[model samples]
Target: MKKIDWYFDFISPFSYLQGELLHTLPAEVEIRYKPVLFAGLLNHWDNKGPAEIAPKRTWTFEHCAWLACKHGIPMTMPPHHPFNPLPLLRLAIALGSSPEVVQRLFRWVWREGRVPTDEIYWQALLKEFDATPEMLDAPGVKQQLRANGEAAIAAGVFGVPTAVVDNRCFWGLDSTDMLIAWLRDDPFFSSEQLRQAQQLPQGVHRKT
Candidate 1:
């Protein structure tokens, strides 16, 4: 079975939408979540920061709402964002190999809009996984997460919810359906062709 590498940022609205329904992988498919630093990409592209990008931000909110409606997951604009994706990203990298924990945290934050910075929130997020909050802020977690972010850049990912299947980069949440199909080798899901012809809002960075 091929593993789907999910490089995601909790701060990404699209990723929030994708994450909610993303777990329905077939028995042969496995998801590997890499909590990546979206801030670094924003800084690199010189794009409008997540908060300032009005169109992207608004689109993110609406897109999430639409996906929530479709998936039956309750989602709302987070109370706060432009969150330090650092800690969360580190948790992903530190536990980079653990899909169980990654899926748990992803659902907690996106489905519930829970920010990990709050100790209680972290506790609640990790409870299902039998993990604890203190391990997140352990010394060097932030720095290590930063290194992972650098690795994301090296991997040619410029945005959230990147799914890399065997070194191929699917750089958007919208592409997950294709990612899934590809992993399954479902003729109906031609990931390679979709990657070639992905119709995305290009040339415009999520408008602010």
Candidate 2:
């Protein structure tokens, strides 16, 4: 079976949306759910998240809400954007990071609009997992999370909701169709124009 590594974080609404659509991939494909800290990626790339910018943050949520409606996926923004996703990431790793656990965690945050800081709801989530906060804090779980982050960087992942297939990083929720097409062996992927596109030279770089 073809394997795709899905890199995501609970802090991203796009990640949650993409998780809902993973069912659309070909049946023969295997999805490996990877929960990585989005912030870690930003740090590695010396980049800023969409939510770090004021106006982009507004547009990002608005666009995601529109996309959710268009796709008929249930999505509600959490009480806050860009919250620490380490706890949730560790929890998923601690629970083995299965598709079920990852999807459930995404829904807990995006579908239900809840954060880990919400005592009552958070407690209920822990009960559902048969786990406690202490369990999530285990050193092994934390180390696994770190390893996932390292793996993501090695895979050239600069964003969440990325699907790494054959070492090609298809980043963003909007690239789902491209990913599906590529998986089905679309000829455009092998076209000369595509090859040339990859060789395009940078005209300029923005001053840091």
Candidate 3:
């Protein structure tokens, strides 16, 4: 069976969006869910998240809403954007929850639009999953999250909702269709070497 390594962060709306389409993958393909921190990845790459910029944040909200509505999926932006996702990530990992649990977390944050800041909220959520705070507070949970982040960086993954099949990385929610095509062994846009070779030298930057 073919394997797909799916890297995602619970705080990313794009990740939530992509989760809706994960069922489309062929039954023969095995998916491995990897929970990584979006903030950590951004920091590693020296990149800015969509919520970090005012213009991008505004556009992201509107765009996400449109997409949810278009796809007939329930979606409501959480009270806060880009809030700390460590708790959820740790909780998921510590509980050894399946990918479906991750999807539920996304809905709690995105579709139900709830902020996980309160202890009461977390307790209630945990109870629903038959987990306790002690599980989330386990000593190894934090390290596990860190290890996941580091592993993602080492795997050429720069962002969430990424799909890696045999070392080929596909980033972003918009790349789902392309990823599906790739899983079926379809021809891609171009080989990496060909793409680099076709690039034109710009201005005086070339051998001037």
Candidate 1 off by > 4 Å: 92-97, 117-134, 137-140, 184-208
TM-score for every candidate vs. truth? 0.73, 0.98, 0.89
Better of 2 and 3 by lDDT: 2
Over 42-108, each residue of candidate 2 has an lDDT whose tens digit, in order, gives 9999999999899999999999999999999988788887787777898899999999999899999
| Model 1 TM-score, 2 decimals | 0.73
The weakest ten consecutive residues by lDDT in model 2 span 78-87
Per-residue lDDT of model 3, residues 44-103, tens digit only: 888999998999999988998898888887888787887888888887798664777888
Pick by lDDT: 1 or 3, better one: 3
Model 3 scores worst on lDDT over the 10 consecutive residues at 199-208
lDDT of 1 by residue, 81-179 (tens): 766655566666556437666666666676677786777777665675555556667666666666667877877778887877777787776777667
Error of 2 at 76 (Å): 1.6
Higher TM-score: candidate 1 or 3? 3
Model 3 error, position 39 (Å) = 0.9
- Candidate lDDT values, in order: 0.69, 0.92, 0.84
lDDT of 1 at 181: 68
